[model samples]
Target: MVYTKNKNKNLIGDKVKYARLKNKPKITQNDLLARLAVRGITLEKTAISKIESKTRPVTDKELVAIADALGVSILWLLGRE
Candidate 1:
C-alpha cells in the first residue's frame, strides 16, 4: 500500500498564498521570498506565484519555511487548525 499525504488535491498552495496576501499588511510573493531567505530557505517569486496558482506542489521543508515566514502554523497552512 502506497499512501500519499495531502496528495494532489490539497489546498496548501492557496492557503499559503492567502496567508501571505490577506493580512493586516498584505505581503507580496517577493516579500515572502525575502523572508524565507532570512530563514535559510531559497525560493523564487515565480515559484511562489505557481504555488499560489496551484500549479506547483509544495514539499514539507518548503511548507515549513513558508509557514514560518508567514507567521502561521503548519497545521493552519494545511487547513487542519
Candidate 2:
C-alpha cells in the first residue's frame, strides 16, 4: 500500500471561504453548512471551518455541492475563473 500527501490539503478552500464571505449577506459557517445540507451534503460546522481554513480535503462530491451551495462554479472554486 502507498499513500501520497498533497502539497495543499485543498485547492478550493480559500476560494470557498472567499465566495461564502463575498456573498451579499456574508454566509456564516453554519449558513454554509445548511446550504450544503439542502443540497444533500451533510457536513459539520467544524468541517466547514476546516474546509475554509484549508485544513481539510474536500471530496469531488463535496466540491460540487459546495459550489452549488455557494452559487459558484467548480472552476471558480478551483480558482480557474
Candidate 3:
C-alpha cells in the first residue's frame, strides 16, 4: 500500500481557529464539536485542539462539517477567499 503524506500539515487549521474565535459569541471548541455532531460528524476535543494547532490533517467531510459549524465557506477555510 502506498501512503501519501500531505504537503501541508493542514489547509484550514488557522482559519478554523480564527472563525471559532471571531464568532459573535465566540464559539468554544466543545461548541464546535457539538455543532459537528449535530451534522453527524464526531470529533474529540483534543482533535479540535490538534486541528487548530495544525498538528492534524482534516478530511474533506470534516472540512465541510467544520465550515458549516463555523458559518464559513470551505473556500475561506482553504484561504481561497
Candidate 4:
C-alpha cells in the first residue's frame, strides 16, 4: 500500500531523523543505509534522505530495523518513551 504524509500522524519521520542524528558518533545517511542493508532492508541513499527529510513514509518493518540499527527502542522512535 502507498503511504502519504498525514498531519495527524505522530511525526515519526521527524523523530527518526532526530534519533539518527543524535546517535553517538553521529550516524550519516550512508552509514544508516549500510546498517539497514545489513539488516536486509535495501533502501537507497535518496530514500534514506527522503525518510529523514520527512518526505517519505517509513514502514513498520523499516521502523523496527532502523531502531535496532540505531540502538534505540521502538518506543523512543515512536515518541512514546
Candidate 5:
C-alpha cells in the first residue's frame, strides 16, 4: 500500500486533497479557516497545512467543519470504511 504522511496512514492526504479539489470553484484553505473561526472554531494556517499534508490528525470537531467547508460529508474526510 502507498504510505502517506498522515498519522493514521489511512488515506488522509488523498481525502484532504479531494476535499480541497471539491471546493475549488469558490472556497480555499484560508477561507475555510476564516469560516470556521466565525463559527467559533479556532484553527491556524499551519494546523490546516499539517493536516492537509497528512502530518497531523483532524480532530473530531474539526472534521465536521472541514466537511462543511468542503461541502462533503464528515465521513468522507475521515476516510470512513
Candidate 6:
C-alpha cells in the first residue's frame, strides 16, 4: 500500500501535522524540534522539517518519537490503522 504524501496519505506526515496543529507553535519546524527534544530524540530542526516534507528519511526510533509526540499509536505511524 502507498502511504506517502502526494503519492498517497502518509501516516507519518499526517501524524506530524496533526501534532503540530494541536500546539500551534511559532514555526512548524521549530515545533517539530521542540517535540523531539521533549522526547529526548535530539534531532535537528531541519531533519524534522525534511521528514515532514518527505525530503529526508527517519529511522525507526525517530518514527517512535514522532508517534509519541503526536499522541498516536506506533502502528498508526506505520500505517497499520
Best by lDDT: 3
* TM-score order of candidates, top first: 3, 2, 1, 4, 5, 6
Q: Each model's TM-score?
A: 0.81, 0.87, 0.88, 0.79, 0.70, 0.66
Which residue pairs of candidate 6 clash? none
Strongest candidate by TM-score: 3
What would the per-residue lDDT of candidate 3 be over residues 2-81, giving only the tens digit for each residue?
Answer: 76885556978889999999888999999999999999999877999999888889999999999998888999999998
As a whole number from 0 to 100, the lDDT of residue 11 in candidate 5 is 38
Kindly provide the TM-score of model 6 when superposed on the true structure, using C-alpha atoms.
0.66
Collision count for each candidate, in order: 0, 0, 0, 0, 0, 0
After superposition, candidate 5 runs with Cα above 4 Å error: 1-11, 24-26
lDDT of each: 0.83, 0.89, 0.91, 0.80, 0.69, 0.69
lDDT of 5 by residue, 1-81 (tens): 776553442335567666676664856678778878876779877876677777777667777776776778776766674
Which stretches of candidate 6 lie above 4 Å from their native place?
1-11, 22-27
Tell me the lDDT of candidate 3. 0.91
lDDT of 2 at 74: 95
Question: Against the hidden true structure, what lDDT does model 1 obtain?
Answer: 0.83
lDDT per residue for candidate 4 within 17-40, as digits (tens), equals 787788778888889899999999
Point out the worst 10-residue segment of candidate 2 by lDDT: 1-10
Would you list the clashing residue pairs of candidate 2?
Answer: none
TM-score (C-alpha, index-matched) for candidate 4: 0.79
Judging by lDDT, tell me the better candidate of 1 and 4. 1
